[model samples]
Target: MNDPYDNCMAACDACAHAYDACTAAYLAERDAQALADCIALDIECAQLCRFASGAMARRSVLTPSVCALCAQACDLCAAECQRHAHDHCRRCALACEACAAMCRAVA
Candidate 1:
């Protein structure tokens, strides 16, 4: 009942929110400096996810290319988040992994 693009868009939107939340949580950590890469990747992944979702929503011709990039961002973010041991990081990693899978399929 759902289109692949629609599903991918939804996943991307969710992952963006997750990444944003993780970034905020990490910023409040005592060793935030150690999470610099994770935070950076979170921001990058969120931005890409938002862009990919927008492109898919409008059925843009470049959706596939955007999705491919989004997938890479999501994967890198997931890997970074997985290096941490916080609940927020775990949640974000899961979301990123799911979004990456969807992006790969959509691409």
Candidate 2:
């Protein structure tokens, strides 16, 4: 069977990448609040991506809803990242955008 989890995994990868970038950026700039927010979102998105991927892989009925939530999270994360004009934020925005697309597709 073709893997539906492919998209989920992609989202997961993007989320994780974005999360790392945001964390690094926050740490570098010492923007504690932004760093905290990004980390929280990143953690949430990462877990969602992992769950969505695993659920999809197992053909769980909850995949769509989970993907939907992932989409929302990615969107928010992207918006937040876009506020800063740094490389890390740019990268995070891109990843979040990609993840959002993937999540929308799955959802």
Candidate 3:
């Protein structure tokens, strides 16, 4: 059966992937030290999105709570990413925004 939160799950998954890529790219940059906060938040947001996606997929009772947290994490991640001018950060920010919106819809 198709889960009601499938779309949100997909969005979360995409956001996780984007965050992962952005973090990796940032780590390789010359100013990696300056982006420490952004990298940390990206990793955290990715993990939260993954967890929320799993909870939603399983139709867990905690889905709402998890989704709400995921939205907040995604929002923060997006803001952090937006502070940088890198293409990867910009892309990740966009993905995070979309994921946050989807999570909010079901939160």
Candidate 4:
């Protein structure tokens, strides 16, 4: 059977990928300067998600704390992404929302 953390880990992975893609897309936009905060949050969220996923995979004692921080990062990233109307941003927001919920559930 799959571990309980599997779903959350997968969600984190998805969120990280989405954030990376969204960040890259924002950098390519004409108003890249306008997305500075969004880009920075995306980077932070992605890194946190990666670390949380690894912690969960390893069944580390710090998984819960890591997940708590990951959830916060995802929430902030989602809010930032939601401020933009771009397709990539919208998709990233959705992923971040899902990931945040999953992280909260495990945390």
Say which candidate scores most in lDDT. Answer: 4
Please report the candidate that would top TM-score against the real structure.
4
Model-by-model lDDT, in order? Answer: 0.91, 0.76, 0.93, 0.94
Q: Estimated TM-score per prediction?
A: 0.94, 0.81, 0.95, 0.97
Q: In candidate 3, which residue ranges exceed 4 Å CA deviation?
A: none
Regions of candidate 4 where Cα sits further than 4 Å from its true position: none
lDDT of 1 by residue, 1-107 (tens): 88779888889999999998999998998998987878888888899999999999889999999999999988888888888788998999999999999999989
lDDT of 3 by residue, 10-68 (tens): 99999999999998998998989988988899899999999999998888999999999
- lDDT per residue, candidate 2, 1-90, as tens digits? 757668667666767766776776677775577568766776676677677667777788988898888788888888988887878788
**Given candidate 1, what's the lDDT at residue 62?**
98
**Which pairs clash (backbone N, Cα, C closer than 3 Å) in model 3?**
none
| Candidates ranked by TM-score | 4, 3, 1, 2
User: Lowest summed lDDT over 10 consecutive residues: which window, candidate 1?
Assistant: 76-85
Q: In candidate 4, what are the lDDT values of residues 1-107, reduced to their tens digit? A: 98999999999999999999999999999989988988898998999999999999999999999999999989988888888889998999999999999999999
Query: Residue 61 lDDT in model 3?
Result: 96
